[model samples]
Target: MNYPKFRKSAELFGVICGGLLISMPAIPQAVAQESTPKINPCPRIFYEEPHNNQVVVPQGCPPNALTQRLAAQGLLPVPATPSQEQTNLGVGGETPQPSVKLPRPASGDQTQQPSPGAVSSDQPPLLQPRQTPSATIALANGTVNIKLVNDTATNVTFQVIGDTAPRSLAGKSDVTLQGLKAPVTVTFEREDGGQLIVTPQASSEPGNLNVTFNEATNAAQGRSAMRVEPNGSVFLN
Candidate 1:
């Protein structure tokens, strides 16, 4: 072949081979599939010490899966002394709020300008007047104060006021909740292989609930537990 024609043919072959290589299917990259979490079995509470008990499961189990959620609902392992304690949670004596006493309407005279935002009714208040603010009562700023202390050896995860993600609390630590607009359920769950739990002690009132996370071996089965519900009731499980 002529020199020019031969060179042109070689260039064409090179271009065609390059195009074919470019159009070929690529080798599949390894697709990174998310692994499924292993299923965990029901948790068990066992005696860790002569005087204490703990709830735990084996390794490779999903952390905080089965038992922690149950504890938050009052369905499992509630404290034994929720109601019997000397302190009354939501109950109290009547103490009238400071107010400007208006002149009494003359007997049988029902017609009067109603106070702004006042509902005139004979029905009594569902909550009787609280005596001077005790510990559990709402504060002057209207935030209910709650204190949680972790007294166990292992770390724990907790949720408050309907939050789904659990926050970690180190052992021998304390946390207080303030400035919450609504009542909340506080749940504390032991991490996998953990044994201890949190318990709510009696408070002076309902707005400020105090709790302690103590050793599982030292706790009363079905008695020592997570904090009381936001509604001011204790659950025994």
Candidate 2:
């Protein structure tokens, strides 16, 4: 064998191997760079408004004419694009909007039935019956006997004009003034400068007068006088 010739062939083989190694690394690096995804430094900024609407904008990004036109027309913050994952989720690439389901009537025919004791819609409502009035019987002519009852919280003084002297009846007390003439006048005043109310309770008995004096708070309702008429009719003033 020629030794010098073999040495020259071996040197050429080593040079080819070194070139292949350097070229192989460059191919892998180019492929890796092409496979890497590019990311935008300025993604959309999202913020909530006072009305709970989301406002989206590319705040620090380059301005686009379409985005500026929509914003000028008061139609800013358009809906976000559905992502690739959401598109492939079998929802037909549409985001489902929120919905509210109201309660329906129980009837299968879609018409609500009237509840128990409820008035029918087609029928007229029943009215209350008219009350029958009682007959008023006239009293016979006689001397009137007056009974005064004080159902109050304070002491009251009353005077029957020309029949009995002025008398003071305590709280929750009663007094009888006998044989008062027709057209009897009685005046009452409270010891505490409060108010007094006089009401005639009964004249059912012949020649008998039954009256009650009650305390009152309203100035319009506080009356001071009671008059017994000749025919047993009563009046308060």
Compare the candidates by TM-score and give the number of the best one: 2
lDDT of 2 by residue, 1-237 (tens): 899999999999999999998899899899999999545433333222321233334544333455555766877664355445544331322344558888876678687668999888899878998533211223445566678888998889999887668889899999887776677788998898898877776667766667788888789989888776665566677
What are the TM-scores, per candidate, against the unseen true structure? 0.33, 0.40
The list of candidate 1 runs beyond 4 A from truth reads: 1-143, 181-183, 203-206, 218-231
User: What is the number of backbone collisions in each predicted candidate, taken in the order shown?
Assistant: 11, 0
Model 1 Cα shift for residue 171 (angstroms) = 0.6
In terms of lDDT, model 1 sits at: 0.52
- How good is model 1 by TM-score? 0.33
lDDT of 1 by residue, 1-237 (tens): 499999999999999999888766442322223344322232222222321223433332222434345556776663333232212221121233457898887878868677888876865868876433212333324445667787777777777746446788888898887645434555666774445544555557546657777666533442323333344444423
Error of 1 at 235 (Å): 3.1
Off by over 4 Å in 2: 1-141
